[model samples]
Target: MFSEKDFIAGQFNTIETASFEWSAPSNIALVKYWGKKENQIPANPSISFTLNNCKTITKLEVAKKSDVSSFSFDLLFEGKPKEDFKPKIQKFFERIEKYCPFLKEYHFKIDTQNTFPHSSGIASSASGMAALAMNIMSLEKALNPAMTEEYFFAKASFLARLGSGSACRSIKGQVVVWGKHAEIDNSSDLFGVEFSDIHPSFKNFQDTILLVDKGEKQVSSTVGHDLMHNHPYSERRFAQAHENLSQMKGVLSKGNVDEFIKIVESEALTLHAMMMTSMPYFILMKPNTLEIINRLWKFRTETHIPVCFTLDAGANVHVLYPENVKEKVLQFIQDELVDYCQKGHYICDQIGDGAKQLN
Candidate 1:
């Protein structure tokens, strides 16, 4: 049974307590979501998986109050207070109010924790914002009782987008599509397609996270997106993402690994291509970044392994290889790429699960 005890006094009443727990999984872009409209609307719809290892657990308790007209929350990262994160939290609240005005009356206390390192380029913001948004919806249901699950997901995703572009997809399960194309207003297109939907023929496909350099990226995603407006290759990059998403969908539907690798890898390169062409010309690739890529290509040519490499906004390299050849692929990375990598670097994990309410 769930508890509905009251812990704080309210203007309507006093000493009321109720709490709910929710978990949100991190996501990896099978087809990346890049560039955005004013206020962070995605340029094109993109899909991703909910990761198992990277996630955030959020608990929220809402108290009714007539005297106090504001909502408050305390945020923590790995059990330590993260005061710097408050502005984003406040912005999230404002976005929620814009969409769900009923929440304006209730005061809230929120607690959140991440399972992975916040500094890791693992998209922790995606999972964290998703968890926070979902928990807010649960509290709304307790207060009004009329909020439907779909309503929760819709409003929560809208809130999540304000926190981070990738966070929008983490609000749902499995394969989530985020952008206006998915829905006219703010709503997810589907609950998610099953992980097996990726294509049975590609069961051998796998990804390796190679930390070429742990130093912070010079170009942040936010800055990168803004640079697209003036980038010489922006149009090409946009067209590539569109084609990549369509091609990846076909590969999933047809179980085509060959096409999958080609599209995913090319799309990643195209994204970076845009970054390099931006005004003032920023290059994310360090010497080690190029070395790993160069070695991976060489190894693929010589060994004939079905392998591909993709890079996100960061310098880390995500090596895609066939599952049967995973050991060989890992060894190649260790022998050829590990020496160039920084210490305390490069951890690997597979695709993960979506967000869920926890008991």
Candidate 2:
């Protein structure tokens, strides 16, 4: 929960329609967070780089109602009505209404669109929920103008986490740390914080997405996270993630590309490995996924380009490399790995500035 410093008593404006818009970027975790507890708390801490091009923009228009006891909202995606999203949005509002009593006093019109496809292994939920949380906090700020800008983001992260755990990390820029860690102070299970003390070389990191599969997943991330509850290796995976985060923190700060590549790739494979070993196993990686990994390994070994691969919960790959070696890496990607991708397509994005409010 946020402290008094986060927000003061609200004074709602009489304006019939108050509009807000915010854009938030998706992130790829370097230290993977695969499992969680109830209330969206991660089993282990994770760190990620906020992406540049892949994002979600959301516009919310609020019309105050005479009664303050009922919540009403309509949602649209890419300007088309998305009736399926209403239940999730309703649950989100219900979860956050305790912290924000004014929620029930308004009828909301939300227009959200993603720069990328849904369920494309890009973590669209992270950016989407973060942007929605940002828009809500924007209105909260209007009601209580005394809140600090830092607290504004903190509150947004807090709210977003209630919707999606990874969404909390999307609220911060460059790099972000979610879940509490002993090495970092002020970290919380409730919100993510910007992990800023890194060497300049790391700030310009690159992630080229290899779209191996564009179709919907056989198992949703929600199901994957749920599977971890009864997973035989769940405890060991949690401890392993903690240990990996400790090692990678030093590697990230020192800009050790070699160690960074190893740790990140390991974490990615370990994440999928956990899924495969679950009670009722499921394989998220395709045969092409393995082919791309082999190609990446061969190319890196022959050329010494320091290229590496990481997978989300889907079949696609996120090729991680330093900015200096981007040209060589991209050339290799085109000549060799792109054939494995769906439609030979990919998205080039880097660590980016965090969520921004347009209005």
Candidate 3:
């Protein structure tokens, strides 16, 4: 168990200037986490597959400042100054400054870019915030060289969660659990934990994301999470998530692909269902989203491919399947599903180890 004091940095060795770079991947939830409590804590535990190919790479350069009165930073996206993104970064700094006391003592230059489209519903905030957190931890590790490897990643995930709840899951790869569960040892509400035990069948899992609609979502995930506060079915939904997570553990351990498909697809639909039943009642899925899903269902039924779908908080559909069926699944996606995508746009990715340090 960790508390706020565990993360507070002590006196640091004097450093004039330093730079660090890291790349963090986005994750797709199998058991979705919808609501939250105070301080970005998840209302229910969730598990996800860390993704490859679609990620955010961030480089942080810091110079010591004479005045430590306020946090100062400049943001760049894809090598271009991005003023619009400053407010979010500023909020993140404010949230994490208490944990990382050196924030106000340095002027930071944050240069970031994404492998996937910026806001194409690929959880850019997750990857972006996660990458930034890893870079910050690198700087901290330099200041305090005695920091252990375990504490380093755990604190990094802790900081990432303040920026975006799901970003915590992006810190570790293949499988990660984000909320505290009785069955999952060492799980916490503060930071995500890597799930090491798994059936070999889950290794190298494939995820082909179909871009049905690239536009920004009608209702942001933040607001959607807020709605759960007063939702009539919120308690039941939270309980269901816990049960689903337990079942998922068994499914993954036993290599039950058919059961995996059922749980994954149901969780995706349940996520959207929560949105539609909210007070304002909004739908993020486009017509093409439904078309692609029906086609996927038909393909899976006729071919018995064990392919399934999961969703983030957007209209994009993530097609999930085992690696052994990669060729057949890709062929099916191209033949029947590509037309439903936006301009036939899709990204082929697989499960990957979490974040990596560039320098």
Candidate 4:
């Protein structure tokens, strides 16, 4: 129930040229959240694995100016000014400006860089927004030393959620669950909670990204989310997600990779199914997408290697497996999946230690 009126700002005022950097990982959703309510609220609860290597690092350089005013900032990407990203940042600031009282007194120069390229089926928004949230949290901490650690992360994830719903989960740990779920304690639609009760085996999982199509999706994630409003199976999809989420806790805790593979792949296909059945009826998966899937199934069967594939909204496939079988999976990727990827490019990543400050 916190509001703008609750914040008490205006302390020490002579601060100048404070900079903070944070790198946050993109997440792969096991139970995909396709739709949303107002305020970026998810239609159903979703769980995801926070990835390493595939990340966005954002540096915020701030200098104090006015005591209390609206947001004024310069935005850049990879040391270059990104005019395309400004409007989105502006809108995001507008939504959460009231909460960040420190934002009013400082001018932010945000420079962002991503490890993976754009429109490459990686959740850049999640990582970028999460990094930005951590940067702002850094600023707030510098301004007010009294802020508690629990509130610090809660507010950080809360602010990130205003930018991107998935970004909320990115601010947490190895695995996170976003949205209100009956199975989890203290779960809320406001911010994500880290999946703490996981088995040690699940912690070392690897995600090998097989890039089927590097190009942008025909239907943007925003449009796809909007289309869920009129989608015939929206209700059922949400229900299925809830059921899957309840089951996922068990799968994760018991280290059930088999059930994990089943639920994860089913969720991936179901996400695409919703997209195909949308009013516009478009498909994001390329021919190579299916080819890679078939190859993964065949390879898993023949070698008895525990490898499974789950897809995002785009055409790329994320080949997920335990770290113990990394050698076999990488060999399979090079031998079978590489040809299907655009220009034979793929990325190898793993479950990360969550976002961190880069000093």
TM-score of each: 0.84, 0.96, 0.99, 0.95
- lDDT score, residue 69, model 3? 91
On TM-score, who's better, 1 or 2? 2
Candidate 1, residues 1-359, lDDT tens digits: the string is 10111211122222356788899987767677667777677766676655566689988777666754665666766667788988888887775565555555656667788776566665577888888877866765666565566656665666677778788777765556564332222323322223335556554346577777666677788888887776666676666666666666667768776777787777677767777777867888778878888888899889888888887787878787667788998888778888767673676655555678996
Lowest-scoring 10 consecutive residues by lDDT in candidate 4? 1-10
Ranking by TM-score: 3, 2, 4, 1
| Pairs of residues at least 3 apart in sequence or in different chains that clash in candidate 2 | none
Q: Give me the candidate number with maximum lDDT.
A: 3
Instruction: Point out the higher-scoring one by lDDT: 3 or 4.
Output: 3
Best of the two (3, 4) by TM-score: 3
Q: Which stretches of candidate 4 lie over 4 Å from their true place?
A: 1-14, 67-70
Model 2 RMSD in angstroms: 1.9
Residue 53 Cα positional deviation in candidate 4, in Å, after optimal superposition? 0.6
Kindly indicate the candidate among 1 and 3 with the higher TM-score: 3
Query: lDDT per model, in order?
Result: 0.68, 0.88, 0.93, 0.88
Clashing pairs in 3: none
